[model samples]
Target: MIVDANVRFEALSALLGTKITSLSGGNPWKAAPALSVDDFFIQLILNKKTSYAEEFFIDEKEFFDPGYDFDFTNLSDSAACMRGNEPYVRPKGWYRMALKVRGKYLDGDAWLGTNGWRSYSVPGEWPVSYHGTGLEGARGIIRTHYKAGDGQQFGRGIYSTPKLNEAEKYCKTFKSKFTGKTYKVIMQNRIKPEKRQIIGNYWLIPVLAGTSAEEEKRIAESSIRPYGVLIKEM
Candidate 1:
């Protein structure tokens, strides 16, 4: 679920309070302060499930899916405020499959751009405008580590790549873990892989969570940040 972006090495450092020295900037290439999850918000995500489902498996987005969309659950006019292509604002009806998900969070290819900046031009880099995905992409990834299987590509038993035949494979696995779990997930876009296009394809995201510094580094290594401007830009 880690959405790939040119997060300045400092952007995360500011929040985690890790004293990382800058290789290029020398004076801490990271942003001024550390990042804090206190004020951060969660953009939930769930593809339309053919059957009943409480949650959907979040997988890794490839180089074609745009990974910079925003989440708009707390907004007053979430529907209206999120209408059209504003920074972080998705085009109206972009998430047409949003028939279910209870509106807890915006489902599908959502993202996390602080302050809802969704313009073609990003803060540090990112020249292309992020028209969709929204915040569900970011939260979908974070949730995987704590509750569901492993993040994006590390598919345990629950979530997996588009190669799988059934998307609800985890309903039974975790069902026994949590009794009364009478729900299963279905990739509404299954059978016809083209339906997945309704969510866009481009860019990859690598989510980094947990209290382990070593674990976070491991996540960073295997991440395919085709959109990275910091390293590539360097």
Candidate 2:
């Protein structure tokens, strides 16, 4: 269950709009948008993206919550409109489109899990603002509740969100999950200040499935490989 550190990450600025970028000045970000080009590296240069976008993952803090399918009641808007401190409004058309798909929203899950096409969006929709997908997309929020209450609070879902950082902060944080511990931060090449443009892009990177390096192999085998999947495997 140990995560292969060798695992890598990549991203696109937008989906379904011919996502493309141009490499302009000495500064990687001076680049402009091109046409239908898929540049995994653009995600690293833009500070507007999530930390995992830049190729490095900062370790985050583990969180806790008794309820599994909870919602952040403070916001005056629906669950999909809020991310961190920013309130994004999905274009009316996109919102309607998502509804057409009838995607099911997980309790505190960052995005719409539509027919297994998993995605986490700030505003949530067709234009699809995502750091990446799966674990890479859920990293930031994972830092929010690390070491939170040891037990559940009320329902079946987790309730939380994460703050911001310059890689250094999250680089050392760790998040505990029902399955295992997930840590994230900026990747190597994207750590330089100038290349941070894409790192700033905010998308919820999740803890892709894996085991903690610190645990004994046998312990991992006995305790669980993936917590939800019952039975033993060796």
Candidate 3:
């Protein structure tokens, strides 16, 4: 599960519009009305018609919750401090899109199975972490699972951070021709407490020092799950 240290993360800004065009038989975004950066990313991820695709669909089921709002409750003290101290990061930021996907070995999960996707913040489950990535990376994760080789800093596992500022450091910038502005995406994930190892600021899903390749992959697929997508305009 190890990746070469020389590998570089390519910026996907150049391909965003092209990909959308192919999927939609043209650059539908251009013909559509003006939208904020938040709505743009949400539309891309949902992969639905822009005219009436405001609701977020989890596992093909429509969830009634709509609109974005700042969540001030249920946040830990450290979360508050990081958001408060950071200049660009807002403590009262809203999650415009909710992405709750069930991964392998999660059918029988105690927390998720009992309370369902709505119980994302319930205690005694996986803790929250943020993984900053480009639009391509976000697409891959939402469509499938995380590729172990995508991250190699801490030995080939999904990389994330508890602090938003730290995660923001890894966020790749994309200049949108449609909006004439730049945007960044951060995946709000839940890391299994028992399967993850914290080394300084990075949180890695698998302990891959002496494990087989298959084992490392399994731990990664089951341990980390993305529940939300957070985007910021830079």
Q: Tens digits of per-residue lDDT for model 3 on 1-234?
A: 111111101112221232221112334444533333233333333222345532221111222122322242333443322111121233233232443343324354443322322322444456667766544554222222343455533444455667677677656566555555565656665666677666666666544456654554455556765555554555
* Runs with alpha carbons beyond 4 Å of true place in candidate 3: 1-95, 102-105, 108-121, 134-154, 207-216
Ranking by TM-score: 3, 1, 2
Listed per model in order, the count of residue pairs whose N, CA or C atoms clash below 3 Å is 33, 57, 0
lDDT of 1 at 151: 36
TM-score of 1: 0.19
TM accuracy, model 3: 0.50
- Specify the highest-TM-score model's number: 3
Instruction: For candidate 1, give the lDDT.
Output: 0.23
Error of 3 at 79 (Å): 9.0
List model 2 lDDT by residue over 146-186, tens digit each: 23244422211111222222222333222323234443322
Alpha-carbon RMSD to native, per candidate: 18.3, 19.8, 12.4
The positional error of residue 158 in candidate 1, measured at the CA in angstroms, is: 12
Model 2 TM-score? 0.17
Top-scoring candidate (lDDT): 3
- As for lDDT, the candidate ahead, 2 or 3, is 3
The whole-model lDDT of each prediction reads 0.23, 0.22, 0.43
